[model samples]
Target: MGAAQDPNSPVVHLPAGRLRGATEGGVTVFRRVPYAAPPVGGLRWRPAQPRTGWSGTRDATADGPSAPQPYTEGGDPILGGHGSPPFDDDCLTLNLWTPSADDAGRPVLVWIHGGGFVSGSGSLPNYSGEAFARNGDLVVVSINYRIGPLGYLYFGADGAPGAEESGNFWLTDQVAALRWVHDHIAHFGGDPDRITVAGQSGGAVSIAALAGHPDAQGLFRRAILQSPPLGLHIPTPAEYLPRTGAYLRLAGARDVDGLRALSWPQLIEAAQGLFGETTRWGHWPTPFLPVRDGVTLHRHPARTLLYDAAADIDVMVGWTRDEATFGFALDEGYATATRDQVVERIAESFPDRAAEVYGAYEKERAGARPVDVLMDLISDELFRVPCVELAEARAELGRPVWAYEFDFPTPALQGRLAATHCLELPFVFGDFATWSHAPFLSGIDPEVRAGLGHAMHQAWIAFVRTGDPNHPDLPVWERYAAPSRTTLRFDAVTAAVEDPVGVSRRLHHRASP
Candidate 1:
């Protein structure tokens, strides 16, 4: 239904119904507009269906519930505040902030939040769309998809109808949201043809997978992958079934209905063991993530992108300098780790390439302790090398691939947390003060924040408008090419460097698992 009449409220008629939104800072924003029907009851574990049309204007002024998720245990502060908006099963909603609803043909940027596919919704304060709409004159849309076991766990037995359709339901939800944008975003003044799907970490991984999926083709013209874990491919049914079985046994569910009947607390309890906090690196013992179930998703996204899949779409990919610092901050022991401890951890994590991994990082990071070297190894393996490889692969296909490295460190915690994972988000969104009170951004200098934030926010706008991220405010950034590997390093002093951190790239190429 529609809200009470007010001059400040703006109304846009979506395909489903009329949506009344609030006008703030010269932009009209509609919060929590459903893109799909609630994925509960019979819809649970199945693909998201179209949101049934309504008779009146639905109240779009309030925030919506997020997918069910367990509490975040990491020491990173930014991760803690994500679950605050609300949580519910009927959570496949999207928020839009537009300059006007007058067929402006403004570029659309659809954001997918990062929580390793288990947590995070689009309504986080950090994801507020007002800045983008106010500053860039574009339509900014952020969406929420399924998370946790309800979104990723496969329960259908071999050849079972439920199991086949149940897998990749989260990806299905995202696709449904994109389809909704294709059909209805024009009403919100966004160009349906010029949509850019961008995400960080797991969200970036989702974009990578979407790039490979044939069904997702033509929905978006360009993609921006920020710190995607390229090496973390989707699991095969065989690899994931045993974990699913264990979850069933833990929950005492004898059948699929019994599994779906489990409550949120019960489901989280059954799946809690999957995420062990003891590991120094980010390794989920049982991740409820996308699987290569031969239906929704087929092959590894990074590999598929290499062979001309989504090659027609322009791409921009990059990662932060100290990507593993978040993992280390989560485990304090790593800060004071002994040299032997470091070697042992490396051997345990990468048994086949322990020597090569050690030699490569140690040679480049001389005078550093084994612990520091180990951190570098994990960082490169987890993020740095994978991002570079993705760019190289796409560049090899002769597509426009822009590579970057975010080297700007925050002045938080006595400078311990360097340019780590998730740090670039505030700058990209132009909301540094929003995260100033968070644990991860305690000592951020105002001047540094403004300078870097301006560069990043403008660059993203440039990317959305035209398929290129280059803007006059920044350096002459070049598209990625073999050997040359031109990359824009965003820092206190942004520079266009040629193949920054080549040592780690070579090591990853030599010792990849």
Candidate 2:
């Protein structure tokens, strides 16, 4: 955590300035490197501006602040929030890792952290690029963007004040980060042309949007979307416009200047309040999504996704075996949840098909608790079905797409967590220290962790290295298609299955009205 200069550190020169990075554990790590100008003052609520070059070598040895976000006391059990990096408006920075800053022509991997578009930073320890660099021999980059109201709050049809491009600063910041990597990654031994964008949850949703985005399509050649809340769909500015007053009221701000004058903590407090005030459970995951602003983004990426513009881009999409099973951690009522409660939950998301959905779920999880049924139902609706739909959309265009499911249910809490929402992160990053606080890995077997971790890690590396995720370690993985719906299942025994969840996928068809 020290910011002192290390004489032996690697210094990579870029368009912005010279960046000195810390080398450790056989990888060079660059922390808190700015990709865009600080979104502050008049720039607040506006699209990200390009970073200006510095006069001298910029220190990239220490991690800076995370994007301004709401405070979750004691932190998130699954994601871990307490004792995390502090927040600031100058949060649009990125971290990079390279085996050596040479002309290796290595493929690059860029990560977008997921926090439901509300919280999360690329500087998170689990997102460290060391494993990718040391193991895969690839240049890795993880980036940050504005989040919550600061990044996503929308103005009316009149547009934002003091800036030309209106809302979706969140999405704009991402575009700028990808552009930064695409432009200057070569100085860090990364092949800009071979970049792959990877994200999970809200980050995954961002990748989907970036695919069709005019500004972001050419930034990366491949994409990996894990557990995106695609079923909820992206909201239009019209939908966002209604929520604007809540923030203004919270900050007592009539204009962008008045709002920006407030501290980040105050703004994030307002952001949390706005989301908590009226947003329902179904919309909770996307409380602050990048709006379908016709300017930067032409169409919604995951909801009824049609990526005709970026069809040629390779995609790898998947979810946890029990994606929604993690809902219990968020809400304890599921412990005593009843069939009535399950029906009510279904009605919120699908009112027209509540009875049909409930019946289908009941049949799927026969003799299971109502809470379990609700978890499975919400999991499919919120995460799995959308993942399938996204892959299906990519495949229908006659393009290459691979799919897989992470099924290593955590032995934590007597295995109540199961294979939950973010369980794959530790496995993917293969960093136990970063995930030390993670409740799911509290007492899990190291061997189990290492086995699945290596399998998933190699698969990701293979996908980034070559457009195909097929590696000899796993089975002959096939592209996801109709009927077979081949999906690689990650578990104690890594194997590829033909439509393993075919029954679950088909039951909805029978139940849909």
Candidate 3:
């Protein structure tokens, strides 16, 4: 992609036809290229089909629409931006940034945005691929998959059209995107064999699951999972089937067609309650999760990865130092949390290991309040311990693995956020301007931004180019192992540390429901 082509021409000829791109900073940027047919009308719940070729040069200058999903309660994207971007059911497009059109065979990087499987699109400014393409001399691609009920709802009942194929249609959309890139990326000067899938939060969870899927094995060689909720349950048909009837009752739909006939607002209204309904394995009440359909996704993503399908690929897994601080301290949940409220929350979140979780966090935060201990407990149980376990599993399998702990505290909101969830996003993209109005990053200045941004950006670029994430900007990092659990702690003074979350790892045992 770095090799020089016709500088005046910003068009690439593909088998589908031709794509005209916009030039910015010496990189040709293409937005909203369809990887699959629109999932609307009769295709609402069907498996994604290949996007047909165009007859003429298609204009790929504008961003794509987001999938039909409900808005965040406050309309604030602490991870990306505020409010909802344009949305539609016919939203299945990808954005690409490449250095040039010539055959350079540069490594390809595919980014999957995180919104807890409910919101966020690939076209968000924070995931802008120009910086990655320009700096790394490569081609960067970010894709959009369906979210919300349309993405995760499981209706295992027969005669529900596509329900029998698989309930996790979002994962199907992801496979289609990778297949498109595998077949077509080389035409855009990217190497099909050098694909590296990188994602954060829910996107991380999706990528982790996709990495272990047998159907998705050869599409990508490596993966980067940032704060994946591995302990989060993947509901089977028995667990999710009843919710289908509840949805039907709420929407007044007698059957699948009746459900399809309803508008998005109606669909979202009926499904909204499911988001907060606590399941037996739910720690955060995320009911609209990837379903474990025996045909496609047979087991929990972590279990499938660790024990079976993850033998071939290499991965990097990590979490923020104070993941729950994003909610506890930033939203004033800490100040108002009652003793009983804290206890109930902890018990509900970790029913079986309540005592063990409490003791571990109490030792970790000595002299801290019960609420404070609860905050770290939720953080480790959902993210820290699960992340460590994932790396440890890869180490046990003798596959290459790298682990990290993002410890850079945001000085925003009067310095309350201490390395909270989604804080490291800007650094990875090297674009603080895109997140200019983000509340989590409000007070972090440009100088502090540049140092960390350069380090992470370089490290990710190196990971794409090579399998390893090590570069000169950070310390000498080693692969995560059992006894020492070597990890790279990224901060103002970044260094490699051993057994950073050793206490929590010992106390916690992840059992997927």
lDDT string for model 1 (1-513, tens) is 334367557888766678888876788888989999999887888888888889987778888988888765442464445566357888999999999977888899999998877778898778888888888898999999988878888754572345454488889999999988887888989889999999998899899888877777789988999988766646888887776776677778865678777777678777676664212343433367678888877887666566565868889999998877776754566677776676676787678877666776787866776666876877776688888877877777687899999998777777776788888998899976566546776677778878999999999989988988888889999999987999999999998999996887866564322
lDDT of 2 at 321: 84
- Superposed by TM-score, candidate 3 places the C-alpha of residue 346 at a distance from the truth, in angstroms, of 3.5
How do these models rank on TM-score, best leading? 2, 1, 3
Can you tell me which runs of candidate 3 are displaced by over 4 Å? 1-9, 72-74, 77-80, 159-162, 276-282, 307-309, 328-334, 348-356, 509-513
Kindly give the stretch of ten consecutive residues in candidate 3 with the minimal lDDT sum. 276-285
lDDT, each prediction: 0.80, 0.80, 0.80
Q: Once model 2 is optimally superposed onto the true structure by TM-score, how far is the C-alpha of residue 445 displaced, in angstroms?
A: 2.1
After superposition, the stretches of candidate 2 with alpha carbons farther than 4 Å from their true spots are: 1-4, 159-165, 281-285, 303-305, 349-353, 510-513
What is residue 418's positional error in candidate 2, in angstroms?
Answer: 0.9
Question: What lDDT, from 0 to 1, does candidate 3 have?
Answer: 0.80
Prediction-by-prediction clash tally:
2, 0, 0
Q: Give the TM-score of candidate 3.
A: 0.92
How far residue 207's Cα lies from its native spot in candidate 3, in Å, is: 1.1
TM-score for candidate 1, residues paired by index: 0.94
